[model samples]
Target: MDATIAALEELTPVSSSFAPIDDSAYIRFARTSPGTRTPVLIFNAIGVSSELFLPLSLSLVAAGHSVVLWEYGRVGDDGDTFFSRVQSYKALLGHLRAGLYDLGLEDCHAVTLCNGASVLARLQAELPFAVSRAALISPYFNLLHVPHQSPYETALVPLLMKAATDEGGAARFVHSVLNRGGHAVASKEALSKAHMASPRSIAGYSRMLRDYRRHDETDVLRRVKGELHAFYCLDDEAVSTDYLEAIRSAKPSIGLSTYAGGGHYGIVDNPSLLADVTAYLGGDR
Candidate 1:
């Protein structure tokens, strides 16, 4: 247990604070020390807590940029309403915007991964304070376009529930999601974090997988005004090449960074990928 705590401490020493989105819910957020440039906001994939992005956060902080890591709102089963969900999304963004305001940042760069990328781009079109620039890692513009995909093809609720309660289940799920292409391995810290996730969070991820097929960001992408950068992992199983190709075809101006070796999560931890992200955020590219 000492070793595990030490490992997690090395990964993410900074702790998180609660930022309220409403009376009933709040987002878990953590910020690193300010860097030479504007702060960066990082959004994780479904079922992936802010802890998963600690390596990236550490890198950004080392590069002299403050980084913010946030988890999405929990979706409860009792009062599930489409309108309520939409409002939650809006409130979440407002909460994020508030985080920036509290930090005294007029504008900052956004780094979003997987489904979070889609969510950010969609909300950016409607938000009052837009990100100055954005970096996307293994993004999905449309969940339906992923190869061999279907609506709720994977039973995430039960699996995540099991994972939350059992260390072995958490290890299995973490390996399947994070360690892809036989390149990445699940860290003990990662597994422990997965096992400690709240049931509400697990339900939220299940709901996202079940309903994400209905929300397409094509129109939102067209209207997005910020300078955009996308990183694609060739071996990532969860995302599709077709969706990226379609995005590139539709938006010719968006910059793309492809990694032949790094898997989805691995790419975020790669030094080269981090350099590219920092460059883009710094307007050096």
Candidate 2:
């Protein structure tokens, strides 16, 4: 790790060249980094929507690790129904693997946030890969195995699917319901603007909730072959401590990193989390 960072410092002798992308919807790769250390491959939380994980990806790249943001936009037919299941990730895993081979990043450290970790964990269990380490940030999986009381997230799966399919009517209904109930904070305008912005992700979330049993995150956690690390904010309103306890019960081998604050999306909003994850992925741990 030191050697890789040394190589990075040698190559990049100036300030960090991280560019800020609008809405955090794009990915930027490391132009130069030693491949001796494992690469960090991020699985964007909501299928092709890279917004949630973009900050961490940028941090890892700035820290001189080759961070590969996955490509699921080209998946499925015109990328509409992509990432609907673990098989979807399986399909692109080969493509991602091929890209890694081309770039000499075959050995990897898998990093994902929220629901995407479900698919990623299942991928490792069903079809093992070369991931030596994994980081799941505020993961919400095993919906059936665990208990949840979020009306908008759980009870409204069908309605959410409708919102994804026919956004005109259902989106407003959902946004109104969730917003009125203090569930989500996206502006009504933002919700409306998301009409066709990420149909694939919207649809996939519906499936994730509807078919939660298929993910079997508990089994995946128990069966994971690498050093699995799960991060969470103790006070996260969205994902509570019960979920953390469930993960511990499922697999005692997995490591847990809990913080007093940072909430659900702390990896993006918290500077300490950004630095900690960057250091961990850079092989400092």
Candidate 3:
């Protein structure tokens, strides 16, 4: 683990406070501020908790902006008994926005990573009044293929689930995934630290992967009103860049940036990528 990330992990606090959206669901978010009037809401990847984005969220807070990171249904240590099984993505966004409003943040910008991008895009489409701008890192609107139940993933996930219940398991899973791409953008060391900080995050992430295959948003992208910025790594093995190009072409007005390499989780691995996203959200691009 990098010393800087380790130190930041130590300083960051875990958030448990939540607001009920319905009898079955609620939202949890983390807040940090540098006293900026304009707040930024970060929608994290499906399985990972909002804590995965803490390093970057803290940077945004330090830069004089308020940062809010939200955890989706079934993704955290919070109770999941009430989580809706209906797959209503729009309702999920509404729940999250209500939580943000409760925090006294009205107008806001947004940043989303991986599968979280589609949710953010859908939110902009459904509730244009709340969000002003968005930045998507390693965005994925669809999976390249429905992951078949390989004996490897099927057998491995259970073991991963067991180990991931503690700090050490989180560290191993993060290392294993990041290592697959040679740590070009997200170094194995950085991922290891993040895992130790939030061990059970993979369970949520795995659930996300399962749920995403059942949801599609081609219609929503064609209707978004907010300015959108998308970043993709050319070598990403997880999701195809063709989807990014399709989105860019669908909305020619939307700005797009592509990097040479960062595999699937590159956004977490590279701070420079976040810098680009921050600039776009700030209207510097």
* Regions of model 3 farther than 4 Å from truth: 1-16, 20-26, 73-91, 125-129, 143-212
Tens-digit lDDT track of model 1 for 1-285? 223223434644654566565665555566655557888877676445565666666666666677766654332222322213433344445666565456544467888877777667766654556687888887766634444332222433346445434535453664355334543333424522432233333344434444555566677667666788888766665555666777776677788888875656654446687778777777778
lDDT of 2 by residue, 75-183 (tens): 2232333334332334444444444344444557878777667656656543334788888787767646677644334556568767545535665565455445454
Best by TM-score: 1
Provide TM-scores for the models. Answer: 0.69, 0.66, 0.66
RMSD of each: 6.8, 7.8, 7.0
Better structure of 2 and 3 per TM-score: 2
- Highest lDDT scorer: 1
Give the per-residue Cα lDDT of candidate 1 at 164: 37
Going through the candidates in the order shown, the clash numbers are: 3, 0, 4
Query: TM-score-based ranking, best first?
Result: 1, 2, 3
Clashing residue pairs in candidate 1, if any?
A: 35-64, 35-65, 36-64
Q: For candidate 3, lDDT tens digit of each residue in 58-90?
A: 666556666666554434232232222323344
Single out the weakest 10-residue window by summed lDDT for candidate 3.
Answer: 77-86
Which residue pairs clash within candidate 2?
A: none
lDDT agreement of model 2 with the native: 0.55
